[model samples]
Target: MTMPDINYDILRRVAETASAYRYKDIWITVGPEDGQLVIRVHDAKPTCEDCAIFPIAKVDYGSSPSVEVATIGSESNPVDLLNLEVPAGQMIPAGTYAADAVFWSQSAVEKFMIPYYASVYGDQADVVVQTLLTVLKPAAQDGSEPDPAFAIAHLPGSEYVTLANEGLPHLFLIRQSGRVEGAAKR
Candidate 1:
């Protein structure tokens, strides 16, 4: 099947709503013409000269029976900006998928997340937490699962905020398979 047409206005709204709850510098966007989704983190350069932003996406497929986290962009750009983009065919299959992502700085993860996970996993925390920062390919096309070694955390209520919001910039995605969908943020 072909990739579906995306509604980017909804993605902006989702980012705006999530921006209120947490980080304001982060924004989520989708390229309708290219059929790609992007999560961008901006304005870190002035605050921290050595800071880098990471967008970690956790995707949950409802029509199908699987949940997966596919990291598409992980390159460390200069401390200013970073964005994670998922091409439609590679990351999202034909089924309906609900995706939510968090934009965390490298320093934040090093200072907070890694240490916290380290307490639980011991020496493996550094390696274990890398799962959240690693670059991952999409699940195999032959119905095989993505790598089981890494587990990415799901950002709760993010997808709901994107879909349930009744205001303008509502998501109105129409898939080729006749399903309607929306993007998410957290």
Candidate 2:
């Protein structure tokens, strides 16, 4: 069976939103086309010099840590930018966290979403996951699970959706099946 498509938008939001909530002066940019993630200080460069912006923790769902799937490296500090990119002459893995719970059960979307957002960026990060599940599950849609393929789309709906839709520009999911395919649009 095919795994669900990982939503770069959600991941980007998790990293950036959380950072913004914590560090309001940081700026983030996603460039999947260039296969890079650039982060820089907004209007605070040259002062802190060593100031660098990075995801405290990415929302990768895989059981293991990130492999060479991308050029997994830190952009040196004191530069105008921090770049996360797929390194040249390296092989990238196929597994990264998408909205696993969202893909599994559409009904659980809200339940999974609230806390996920909280953990990633919302002010409710301190809220217990168990409690969030309890409150959100009861109100979530039931029966049919939403398709994961569309998770990347900037769908129409609530304020949360609108916010989530605004994430790293041009980030994307890379599905895998044995060998690497040339970079193609999903």
Candidate 3:
């Protein structure tokens, strides 16, 4: 079994996009199980205590993280667990490949945490979005060479839009069905 080479920047960009909507934390997980590749995003919960309605009231508090995972495989070799196919012509080659997972929190306090005396608290969303966009553009440009046996579709029932482009080799946008199709060459 081998792991695929994952571009961390791309993963981080995806996480950042997901975090833009007030998610607590965003990170990526890449691993192998039963001769397959598994990718996951782990979203954390906010850390701040809920706003108090009554001055003397105590509110029960705890934080829990949410996780979303997607798996990919070859078009003809769909991953049974995820029902996704791999990109065309690319293979794992039976070796360990570099993988990266980044984690960051998006709590309101964490966003505005500054010295009590500091006069500046800027919105970090723009900065985060810019950085994420920069990282993602290159991957999108290089979409031509993605492994044929691997493809990713947004998790069902999630707000994420599926990614695909006409110029992307072995990848197709199923416009009518709104799904990404992979055509891997044997």
Candidate 4:
């Protein structure tokens, strides 16, 4: 059976709304994995510059908020992001997946915020926070779930965020002893 296609129109609407509201950066990608539909949004980048310098920042830069979303659409058996799970020992299947990532600088606020107006003009701070949240909500919606084909592993800090799409489960193999290994063969 064919998986239900993601509604790009809805995605476009969300993107436009996010952009109109000054979300700044927005993207949408669609693909299939493990015989299931995959829809993902790479809405925002890491907040810290020290973190963003490296490709594998999650490992290199310690911990930061890395937000992503995935969804599987099927009429009879639709699956939400939260419900999906990575298999116990498997790797994410290879496929042509699309990703739209928005990378914005925090320094913009620093540059724009002059010392004199810092107290009175809090609107800038509010807009930045709101835009980030707005752009992230759709991705954080129930539709996005990690593909079960991959594994799920936690990072160093108490708040490490890794999406199944990035091969987290296989990348960081958590042993029974609670120590994490760098690689796990799929």
Candidate 4 TM-score over all chains jointly: 0.18
Model 1, span 3-110: residue lDDT tens: 234444444434444543352234333322223333223323223222223332333333333444444222442111112222343222223334343333445445
lDDT against true structure, model 4? 0.30
Clashing pairs in 4: 70-144, 70-145, 81-144, 81-145, 151-169
Candidate 1 similarity to native, TM-score: 0.21
Poorest lDDT segment (10 consecutive residues) of candidate 2: 152-161
C-alpha lDDT (0 to 100) for residue 55 of candidate 2: 32
TM-score of each: 0.21, 0.22, 0.20, 0.18
Best by lDDT: 1
Superposed by TM-score, candidate 4 places the C-alpha of residue 3 at a distance from the truth, in angstroms, of 11
Q: State the lDDT of candidate 2 residue by residue for 55-172, as single tens digits.
A: 3333344454333322211244211111222222221222222221112233453455545545554443444233333322222256353311212111111111111223312222
Q: lDDT (0-100) at residue 76 of candidate 4? A: 55
Model 4, 145: alpha-carbon shift in Å?
A: 26
lDDT of 3 by residue, 1-186 (tens): 343555553344343334433323343444444443333334532232221111111122444344345223345543332333323422122211111121112232233322210221124344433322232122334567353212222222121222222121212222112233422211
Residue 28's lDDT within candidate 2 is: 33
For all candidates in order, the CA lDDT equals 0.33, 0.29, 0.29, 0.30
* Model 4, runs deviating above 4 Å: 1-4, 7-22, 43-186
